[model samples]
Target: MPRIKPLPDELDPLAAQLVVRLRELKTHGELTMRRLAAGTGYSARSWERYLGGTSLPPRAAVEALARLTGTDPVRLLAMHEIAAASWDIRRAESPGEHEPEEQRRSEDEKGERREQEREQGQPPRRLPHIALTAGVLALTVAFMAALLLVLRLDENVAPAAVATPAGTAATTPPHSYLCRIARTDGRWSAGINNGRDTEISYGDTGTDVAEAQCLLRRAGISPGGIDGMFGPLTLRAVKTFQDRAGLVVDGMLGPRSWKALRG
Candidate 1:
């Protein structure tokens, strides 16, 4: 059994859990990295990165591991969903840090053209002033539309915490949610939170997270502290409950996971 490296301290919590679970599965099957690479059709270096928490493993790679270990792929796939969302969030938050190769190539080409223009004593092409004004107007309209959509969603979903006005330096604190767990018809319900199918995951902060945390405690899995924040501990508790209840362990509180948690 190859020793796995410690996960990065700054790794997304959900992604960290996925890597830990993958490591556990690897150890349970007594499979070496090289063996996993060969069986999964991925390079050993790739497996190292995946298991080491430096990279998110592809769904195909995870499925291949399940196949080789004779384990059900459904649970692993559920975990993948959470990890994938975390990976996407990281990428979105640091777009410039991980620019795509094609985008880099395009930028380089533009830079080269600008250098050539300078060498030839020609001014670089610029957009027309009218075009720029039109673009600004379009952007303003789009922003307004997006703001309206967000307001509509907030009205429909749940009450939102007060937001800081645009161009303000002050930040508003996140809302604190309390769990009001109650037993009704042999099932559990959070009286304050009423969404039966709302999907909550790591980084979510609301009554829904509090509701899941309350149910997780009811299931005898502590979600760390029920602070209404769906952090790493909540994710682990969710996966544990999912595994015990024979539900997919994707770590997200989806419809099926919600059903299991409620039941």
Candidate 2:
């Protein structure tokens, strides 16, 4: 797998969410940029721009990635919509390179229309239309802003899982891990990853997290699902297990937790 560069630090939070999920999907599929390009019908350079957080990806590209990874595209598509909306909002708030030119064109058009109306001895007939348009636009923008705010707050609390046709929504992704617990050399193993002593906490991610999740499940605790993401539920599970096993209940998985998990 190619080493993915870190995303730009100034990226919007909503956009960051989509990009992170995309990176996770790529990791899960074990696909490089070239392979992803070949499979998804996008240029490797474009993929770099999208995955690097320099540019937002199109809806089609996002869906293509989901298909290539053999994952359902619904959640990805919803995320894309939020990212795109957030991008549009940010762009509208910022001045664009073409703003000056567009403003000049708009002024010239208004001047010409005024001159024509003056010559025809007609009063400005566009006032009502412009007022109505502006009012509608203002309302739309306000509603979108409110919606985005609510979504951000909800996401911070709990990430919503997309429901599939066959089942209800779940806290984890559809993919699941099959625990292959076994004893080897007097140490326990779950066959997900040989990651002893790897420190993991909330917001951490990778196969190691997945391994911990698998072990937690085998020990009769739920880590919210083996989706490779260490979120709040996973942290709670770790703490619960630690308390039960008479270890430090710091909720940080380290060597002791790993040993206990493996044991």
The alpha-carbon RMSD values of the candidates against the true structure, listed in the order shown, are 15.6, 12.6
CA-RMSD of model 2: 12.6
Instruction: Return the lDDT, model 1, position 109.
Output: 78
Per-residue lDDT of 1-263 in model 1, one digit per residue for the tens? 34557897767776786788788878866677776887679999899888887678887888778655545454556567556765674564455444543345564775797798799999634445776557655654554454344434422243344343486333222344566778888878876577465898866776788888888888899886666776556777899999998987788888889888888
lDDT of 1: 0.70
lDDT of 2 by residue, 1-263 (tens): 35669987768777888899999888766677887897779999998888888788988798778756646565567777667876765554443312432244564775797798799999533334566557656755764675465445443244345544454342233455667888898877778776466888866777788889888988999876677766556777999999999999999999989999888
Residue 66 local lDDT, model 1 = 65
Find the candidate with the highest TM-score and give its number: 2
* Deviation from native of the Cα of residue 198 in model 1, angstroms: 51
| Candidate 1 vs. true structure, TM-score | 0.38
TM-score of every model versus the real structure: 0.38, 0.41
